[model samples]
Target: MPADSQPASREKPSPAAAPAAPGAGLSAVQRALRKLGLVRDIDFALYLPMRYEDETRVVRLSDVRDGEMAQIEVAVTSNEVVFRPRRQLIVTVDDGSDTCQLRFFNFYPSQQKQLAVGARVRVRGEVRGGFLGRTMMHPTVKAAGTELPEALTPVYSTIAGLAQPALRREVRSGLARARLDETLPAASDWQPAWDLRRSLNFLHYPAPDVAMATLEDHSHPAWQRIKAEELLAQQLSQMQARNERAAQRAPVLAREAGKESLAEQLLAVLPFALTGAQRRVGEEIGRDLAREVPMHRLLQGDVGSGKTVVAALAAALCIDAGHQCALMAPTEILASQHFGKLVDWLDPLLRSRGLRVAWLTGSQKKKERDEMSAAVESGEAALVIGTHAVISEKVRFKKLALAIIDEQHRFGVAQRLALRGKADAGLEPHLLMMSATPIPRTLAMSYYADLDVSTLDELPPGRTPVVTKLVADHRRDEVVERIQAQLQQGRQVYWVCPLIEESEAVDLRNATTTRDELADALGEAVGVGLLHSRMPTAEKQSVMAEFSAGRLHVLVSTTVIEVGVDVPNASLMVIEHAERFGLSQLHQLRGRVGRGAAASACVLLYSANEGGRVGEAARARLRAMAETSDGFEIARRDLEIRGPGEFLGARQSGAPLLRFADLATDTHLLDWARELAPRMLAEHPQLAQRHIDRWLGTRAEYLKA
Candidate 1:
């Protein structure tokens, strides 16, 4: 229920509880808050404030100087209130002729007490205008004789269900309980020996005038120290986990039915020609399957570059080996779409061989899911297409030989490991991690070091080229007319709107409000629809159905449509604010329309001079999109701009974890880290004995993010 909706009586005791109160009875939460590096930076970061001001001074009206901004106590003189029907509420108070009138816009009646007849009170405000009838409108106020401070106050961020003021009080109390000096281990044994006890003391309470100066001395460095510790700890934990997984992975690939023979049989049934890249990737998988050990391979290809085809080959190999295989996707839409394509493409081939496939997902009826699970368990289902639901305990594989993970980056290591964990002992399925985003080799090696990587950099033949152009929003009329003309020609188009929605569940706006506007211009006759994450899963699938089925001439959407939806009928992609997307994302969006053979074109609408802080990277991305359809090149350029964190989704796992390492500049350092990581783990995997382990242990927990 989001917790915040509960009544106060039902509220859990906040971190501000009494134990955190200063005079020595500190609790663990208080200590953690004191040690917390920042004010709610994340679930991990400890961003405690460096210092604070005591907002506890009371001032007299006679002492309030003219033309100064300050908090002062004042007595209310007889009031002459003005109620402007056409304007706002105005109330005045006289502090001996240099009176100030408070101006409030749309004020309610309860606010009248601020200037209650003959009441003396304290107020804080900027003195606007001087002499007779000076003013302070809706400035922060309190009751009479309330103490206020002239020092800048410390504001903090609160976690959900936490209040700002209460949090501040609690933090202050938590600091008291930490007994910073006692909590800090003596620095006698550490390098760069820091007397953290002193640092903590200053953080909690400082000498009068130099409090700010005292904090500035060590606060920033402490923050850096804490962040480094967090990073190291995460690295160590993952390294240890990886070590355990290596030993834990059972032997499934040794069977005679592993992949080679199955791959051959699977390949024999393809109706269309395989691209050279696809063939090469197939050969690699076939070779891996021939090995006695389980195959841990990663297939990285750009959007629409046929990663699924490669995955299908692996699955087919397992099927031929007399075992079942499971394919997992991150989203239901992507899963369903991929599953539909697979069933349509491979069912005919499998039908002749007397085999069948099954599907499972979260939204499926329990009864149907159970039926599929039973079929899979009995070896009646050769291939299972589904989301994470496939890894559930209820669904067991009778002879699970291989696991193909699509959009592998979206799944965590724990999740990736869970799929194989579902298989029986010594029958661990060959693991295949597939990604639509192109990761540079340096980043890939560090992040996916545990697995073998195969890249498909080539596009299939007969694919239409996307002509890219940059145009200002001022040419909307012309762009709208072009869209109308294209719609009239019976061609489908995708109008991609950059992120205008924030809800992760429905974060992609596609073009909600904009779609309404376009609908008005395009008229109700043309089949136009909006597709975004916010719509019910069924609704989104329905929209994709109408568009792919030629019912909708134009489908406006967000990046949600960038992956795995193939409509050979879509001939145009108009990306609004193309400058808003990353290079890889832009390339993916561009790839959407060119799938059809109708000679597709991508119109990149951007703001060149409307001046909203557009950068050279955006222009570079747009130019590159116009220059070539090569995704790898775009990825390389994108890496240069935003780094591999976004593309590889490895920032959290140190995918591109380098301060001194750059995919572009320090390519060698990155390569070195990648090479060293696996080897290091292979040697002293537990790392429980080394100084490196010591440093890493402290840092790894925070890295779980």
Candidate 2:
């Protein structure tokens, strides 16, 4: 279950147990409601129908179309119970125009009484045609001459043991009991034509006259109102979090007067000059670090944009201010890569100042971990770099002032919070989250509104643009020949597989098998290495080291090297079963190449499934890869295919995503909400809080971390 859908109260009862309130105990039905997150009356009111059924008019049996849903009034001519394939109840009915058959695989004793011979009844269900004529496998039966409903009957999304009629009754009761007063200001121009109660009532059971297209597309006035209100609540919560963080204190990082700053010193000694985009974002982070208010910033850059160097500059400023800094990545390979680069750049600089960089990871030996923990506690490690081990309970920072997270979306809310919580008492460390998978524009506007964002839009000079190609798995031999050619040019290759071992469920090439096959095809003269998550830590490190040092001609691995594996000499990346990977993963894997001046290429080797071709969704991902190398474009296309929830990863771990409003189509509403959120909070603070409470409740608290 989702965190928001769990039970409302978890407290134990007192020994003397007070009298229980009406409907307080969790009956089967109540448990079902709790599963739907319908704890309060307002929650039930908002649980609108997923679709509606039209039973307002009856159609003649002769006029019903095959595979179309219809209702007809007819008289039963024969009713019989038969056993064929299985025991079932079959009823033959005839209207004035024609006749039809009704079959029920599961039926109650009372249903037979309702459909007795010579009885008139009304049935509603899908009609299917066969040699025996039209039939409804299981139709809803009702007495004839009964009054038809004036509005469309709603069919709600439900769980087991809860029928639609029972849910309808509870929804009607809750709708009447829920609060429906307006929360927006009276002068707000963004409000739709309909009021809150009218919108909810109409959406629950729309009139028969309403256009089906309007309801299906959610373009009706009532739906517009619901979407607007939902967007407003989200914007308000984000605004509140931003305002609350503004009041908190953090370490004030500033260079000493009349002295060269460490950031400047590091920049002066670098082998390459900083790109304009990197220099601009570096200054932006530098300004934020000098503030007393803790900086909540997101640094977004495309692959190979020189983000690591900019991060190093920020760490230098924090250290120069007489405080320690820590950087965390999601995987050991990425962490080791960052550790190597930081050590190469800042180790000598820090050693000259009586401080050094430290490394920590779960795979480290006990003695090494203990030594690193002590150095962190004593403030001797000016810069600490590692995977999640940096935030482990055993590690403590004496005066940590900056916390940087690479690939921030890969970590959960609690993990990120735990790192921030490592700061000194009554103060927070400035947070800098970095992501190479660029967030789309609308996503940053809504999901990341609380944090300031800096984009590294330009790659450094001398970086080659990678050419992408799509090939069938049948052409594997041709790809091997291309790899040989690249090796002949003294260039390395990365062959990424989707799996490490053969699985009965998924029939794809594994890293180990691919490694052995490639080594044989390329001759023993070409060295091949295999890297995956299941490999021992030291062994994995050794394989990567060999690849980086130009000792290995081809490295076959899983996505463990998706990010932070910077091998400039490696100019070819072949992804086997590329259709099995997400767009972001495909893009990130492709980025591992094209880091050097040599022309690079990424071959997407895909195989058709049992259906004779890959799925349409997978085709779109592959097409996107072949069409462009722009990370932002890929992200936008990805959002369209996968939706926002999966793209966010663990960032919204306990938070409820937008249920009604769409970030793709509701940008106008989002804009209106953004404009009104701060004003409403300033003028009608109570109403603002009440609005958030009604829609988000405790779910909004997740965004605070």
Candidate 3:
């Protein structure tokens, strides 16, 4: 919530605040279900089960497998509670067939109240043969529900203001009213493999496997409908955007690509040759320009893949068109970096050839930002680079022709659209959006399908490969000795941790203590600096400045330094407890090194001392990190490992709201969803099918009427 907003419950709630939709009336605490976008009730018969709780059969003592985790409902026969050494307590109970134990090292009095004499309860625990015979440690007990439905019960994510039973009751009410009739048009002849639409049709709801099965993209008959709606929505949006862009003209850069192309001339003078991929994308932008229609494109490449060079070349083309161009970045540091790169790429030629460039940021003096703003308005500044500060109310462009946005995801659709206001609508600026985090196609089609995509798939020839290794924390001394050897050899290294200070409550590394420890042991001679998001902006900027300028040899930092830091000579990136970071982030940090002629290394230090009860995905990620530096490969594996919701930090990306789909395993389904969706929607535009209408109606927020 925004700081200015009042507490939701305290506000004079409007009638509109009462959910006027299918999920509107969930118990107050059940409101979190809306955030997950997973609860939509059908007629009284079908209910949206949040989770499929498998308690259909109880495990007996004689039949219980050793070390197997299972959920069992049993009648508590007796209480055999005893205290062990070191303030430990052993609470044991029997279900007539077998006995299980709950072990607590420091359990308080309140925890004991959860159990009652001869109470019937359900528990999930790991079974092991201990000195007390078969013992289930730390079992979760609850009063069993009456009238068992003889199937898995759904468990919804709990919200603060809502109670689970109240939500379940209310949803039962709504489901009674949410019966699917013929509101949706018939699904086309085509359908995906799965058909778990019981709730939508008011049929029998899904089983656990069936409920989970709905999570495959375009694999279920329901998805055929859902995916089509997503496709049409995107396709419609793109067509509209294309039509709008068609009315505008590409700025004829003051430099053209041919003999008249100043951009080409500048490129010709560059010390390095452009890669084939770079040249191809440049040509693609050029072609978009030659037409009267404005270009709206995205240029995505890995870190250090020469995306900045591509942007500069595009800027050069815009200049040749005899019009102004605006390049926007999300951060001041990134803006300054881009400005520096542009200056390095264009200045020498401009100094000899006679030209001008302008830089703008909030940090600039009031007079400087205003003066630059005016210069930009008068077309005196050929290229303008800045942060969100560029979007200030006072800033305006003179005949803005090309608008290039860096770190595009950080900005919203409204912000991106607002960039056009700097130019007249009749002559809207062409757009070139860039992203370092490579998004999967389903997400791309769902969110950014309106724009054409140009990817930099190939690396520049002769670029050094970044050797990656995953080291266990048990070998910490050896890794430190190696770091010392590398430091002695005059190479810079970056140490990335998830936190800045050691927290007693959380099991994670902090940069401050790590920096202190490293610098103390290495004796201040190695220049260790600590950086984290909690620091003041100016302080963080200064730390980054030091690290970038080579003043700080060992910078221990948080994920704030995960993206867009270019230090060609820095050869080592040591990620302490790499398992804590997302795969995309780890890959981005690795991209920082191996940019220069020097061979780089990315050392992933995980706490292997912690037994690997961790899932297969974490292990797979470690293996993948050790095996390859290909970001695309890592991204695909990442999607497979963490699932989309978890990979992008759900609250930040909203990728998880795609409740019934998996981006990792649905490549074929997604391709088909992308391909056949338009065809399906074209045939039944009204969404008349029962399943299709239910799916789309459930997700109305993602679509506009």
- Over 1-705, each residue of candidate 2 has an lDDT whose tens digit, in order, gives 432233333222221122247546666777777777777778888898999999999999788779999999999999999999799999999998988899999998999999999999999999999999889999998999999998999988999977889888888778887877778887676658999899999998899899999998889999999999998999999989999999999999997888777788898889999999998999999899999999999999999998899899999999999999999999999999999998988999889899999999999999999999999999999999998899999999999999999999999899999999999999999999999989999999889989999999998999999999999999999999999999999999999988634572242345678899999999989999988777799999999999999899899988888999999999999999999899999999999999999999999999999877999999999999999999999999999989999999988887868888899999999999999999988877777887888888778898888
What's the lDDT for candidate 1?
Answer: 0.65
Q: How far is candidate 3 from the true structure (C-alpha RMSD, Å)?
A: 7.9
TM-score-sorted candidate list, best first: 2, 3, 1
Please give the distance, in angstroms, between residue 42's alpha carbon in candidate 1 and its true position after superposition: 20
The candidate that achieves the highest TM-score relative to the unseen native structure: 2
> Per-residue lDDT tens digits of candidate 3, residues 1-705?
321131212111122224656655654444554543434543122333444545555666667798986766676554545544556656666767777776666566666665555677777677788787877767655566534455455555556765666655655555545543332223434443433344343222344445555432235455554444344433443343444455656554444335556686778877888888899999898787666677878898877777888988888877777777788988776787888788877766555544467787777778877888887888778788888777677888777888899987677555666787787656667888898766666656644555789988788875789999888777877778877877887788888886534462242335667888899878867899887766776787898888888888888877777766777768899998887666777888888788778778999988743555545666788888788777667776776777655644321242213544445544454565555545534454343233333444433222211
Winner of 1 and 2 under lDDT? 2
Better of 1 and 3 by TM-score: 3
Give the winner by lDDT: 2
In model 1, which regions exceed 4 Å deviation?
1-246, 249-262, 351-354, 499-510, 523-525, 607-628, 643-647, 650-665, 671-692, 698-705
